[model samples]
Target: SDYSQEPPRHPALLVNSKEPFNAEPHRSALVTSYVTPVEFFYKRNHGPVPIVDDIDKFSVSITGLIENPKELCMKDILRLPKYAVTATLQCAGNRRTAMSKTRKVKGVGWDIAAIGNAIWGGAKLADVLELIGIPKFSYISPCGGKHVEFVSIDKCKEENGGPYKASIPLSQATNPEADILLAYEMNGETLNRDHGYPLRVIVPGVIGARSVKWLDSINIIAKECQGLFTQKDYKMFPPSVNWDNIDWSTRRPQMDFPIQSAICSLDDVNNLKPGKITIKGYAVSGGGRGIERVEVSIDGGKTWVEASKYQKAGVPYISDDESCDKWAWVLFEAEADVPESTEIVAKAVDIAGNVQPENVEVIWNLRGILNTSWHRVHVQIGR
Candidate 1:
């Protein structure tokens, strides 16, 4: 069956772009469930999904600035020791919608759904790099002798653009804590075509775009991959800056995500019996930082209470491990006696002591990059 043609099953709260690639979901959805099912997980793609007919013939080429070049087939990659990790994949522009509210920005109008968490299974990237003879001492190259580039097997001809490619700094590529992988499976099954079938790079704690899908090649270089996806886009700018008065050269690409949390319950309108109401949601942080605490407020931040940890309805308990570094979001809940008429407000805080901004207007950027703010909902109390 062609999955691409099928409509999304769950309700989508946001839609960033259309056609070959799309991004969706709002911050409110994050707390709806602890384990975001693959069917409901947000989908983010750069180009048309590439079809790989034969797994046997599929091979990833490793070249550039290395003492040895090697081509490893699917069989060869699977033969190497396998590893599993539970991690989250978030788009650099996951909150772009919030940013767009301030000013116009290029690219998709992604909402909070650009991020999701799952168990990723694959070969360790460090092991793969060692097999290809990438010396341990080689410092990752960036713009000039500084970055490592990852190329995808998929290709497309845009109106005036050449091909699409994504890159990352050498530090992110080589960091042991980054948990980079040549992932072949997600949530215990073969990767779906939309999520990059056969093989894709999974860089935990980094932006999803850099985790190039349909991964085909890796070039260890002294300069950043000069692809449009990396250098020309995904950069963050101040709210004061607009398209007409911006300096593209001075901007930096978004790498690590910031601490964020959101309320997943109490939609714009809900009918409550007027006895008790429960608030639920999830909170996460980038750069391998775990969520320390999540606080909920029912009265618009006027007063706060620590949400009961891991007490949400649908979240599964995950044990801590070296490979699974507390990466999954923390599901939280708060139950309170409610009056006949009132509005419900909720927010979250991460391990770094970074609370979700009080108002979207405060952190609203022209591009809607980081929209971490208090989530509010109104409910009518029933007689």
Candidate 2:
């Protein structure tokens, strides 16, 4: 019953779970700013948050596939180059409740606000590894590995009854421009206990699961993460599959999330007043792909209207003249006049031409991990 070490959360958050806390802010209250306040940021935890005693003395072990298998204290990591990355962390289950409507799925049912944007400041994961120095040797060195695994301090029963762990491809981890961070701070302040106090892996443009928190060790392995999450979950399946005939092996784990956008305004249909109503929300594309357009269709997908766009100040995910990287999200707003009743829907198109499917049936899976289908909200339009 005692979650004192879990960090104080905003009372306004809609409680999803208590022990391994999982909650999200009311959608309307969360869209006032481009940067989500950490307190109101959605909390998704799979296990008990470990109580860290000494943050400054916190150490992380780097082992396997590298010449210098050394330990890095907090001080050692800070000495590396510091970089700032603005990104949005969305649980793979964001909007699972919507998918649950079509058919029952076994997972946390998160609404639209299950995603939040934050400014992460820390040493580049690549730079820190460079300082440690990977031995100049063949790929088949003594402990040659193709993936970088991050093991968190939090103990969870779901993951083989051990600490939670996840991994990214070595190529992605080694790329300087990959923008991966050994983040210690969030929104210009020290990370809250609930958000990984001492350290966490900030894997931009990827699912939040990949960003392991309370990072205790880094393992380089020749194979992808064998963690239960990587192996048995976060995957997509066909509509026909059920528990009896399910085969997780046939499907690959979800890495980069596809194009996603949501309507964060107007929580209830009865709350609608009348006439033309202005709606606001956020949109994001994965894998550094930018949102080229966000279209809102109050009359279902038959007709659409372009939404005015906004991105985090100072950081532009997409730019002109020269090339810049995009791992963050873009906020948007659209105004429309409504009548009696209607289905308000919005879909996003990323720069890569990825569009959200018009309906959930085509994208529906058993677990509802990646519900990137067009986000919709039915409203009995008021007078």
Model 1 per-residue lDDT tens digits across residues 231-333: 6677777667777887768877777777776666666567888787788766677777777667776665688787765623544333343433465666778
**Tens-digit lDDT track for model 2 on 152-228?**
98888687558989988777787788899999999999988888878999999998889888999999888888889
Query: Which regions of candidate 2 fall more than 4 Å away from where they truly are?
Result: 1-4, 135-145, 312-325
Q: Candidate 2, residue 367: CA error in Å?
A: 1.2
Q: What is the RMSD of candidate 2?
A: 3.0
For model 2, give the 10-residue run with minimal summed lDDT.
135-144
**C-alpha lDDT of residue 243 in model 2:** 86
Instruction: Please estimate how well model 1 matches the true structure, expressed as its whole-model Cα lDDT.
Output: 0.70
lDDT of each: 0.70, 0.83
Residue 230 CA error for candidate 2 (Å)? 0.7
- Candidate 1, residue 376: Cα displacement in angstroms equals 2.7
Worst 10 residues of 1 by lDDT: 315-324
